[model samples]
Target: MSATRVQVVPNGPVLVSGPVRIEMPDGDVVESDRFMVAICTCRRSDDYPLCDTSHRRCRNVSAAPERLGDRIEREAR
Candidate 1:
């Protein structure tokens, strides 16, 4: 009866636990009581919205924190 626990895993899927409703862009709604679901954020996942662990191959959100800092430093310099 409560809102689902949506956890955004770093460099990974959107970890969803507990009861919740998922609505697709095509106006389709998926309702389920199954907990521990991982929604793909890499976009490169062949499973579309599901995470098949393909994120290991296509790292869409993989970015080194130090690299970003270096870029900032270079730009400031």
Candidate 2:
């Protein structure tokens, strides 16, 4: 069996290698059998633990602006 991987996207959802099963606080279970899954960390997802990409719609870009510039290499280019 291959190991599962989890990647954290800056200001975005966490990427998980599936198939995955998640148990919620209310004893509800969420499962995904896809090759990959996006789990929300920003708590803005309408789907709760599952990301709905709602972070994209957020008006405040509160994360480090310098980090954003670093990622895009604004000066290098």
Candidate 3:
């Protein structure tokens, strides 16, 4: 049996190194031969049990610039 290693990224996924087999709640078994895998911690992933980089913080396009401008205006006043 090969040794398995797990790593926890700050504010990110749990990375697993070495061959792994994941058993899902629905009685599904997922197997991988890759050297590393990222398991999602946040439930927002479209690919459950896998890290698709969805855990990264997204910029709020509709509000971020407006909020910055408002803060600058308030500071100027």
Q: Compare the candidates by TM-score and give the number of the best one.
A: 2
- After superposition on all C-alphas, the RMSD of every candidate to the true structure, in Å, is 8.0, 7.0, 13.1
Query: Per-residue alpha-carbon lDDT of model 3 for 1-77, expressed as tens digits?
Result: 77877766655667899877889999998787889998776655788787788767643223433454456568769
**Cα lDDT for residue 18, candidate 3:** 85
**lDDT of every predicted structure (CA atoms):** 0.68, 0.79, 0.71
Candidate 1 C-alpha lDDT tens digits along 1-77: 66766656667777788755778899987665667787776676786576788878764555443454456567768
The TM-score ranking, best first, is 2, 3, 1
TM-score of 3: 0.65
Worst 10 residues of 2 by lDDT: 61-70
Which is the better candidate, 1 or 2, if ranked by TM-score? 2
User: After superposing candidate 3, which stretches have Cα over 4 Å from the reference?
Assistant: 58-77
Model 3 worst lDDT run, 10 consecutive residues:
58-67
**lDDT tens string, model 2, 1-70?**
9899876677777788979998999999999999999988678888989899888998574565336545
Lowest-sum lDDT 10-residue window in model 1: 60-69
Question: What is the Å distance of residue 52 in model 1 from its true position?
Answer: 0.8
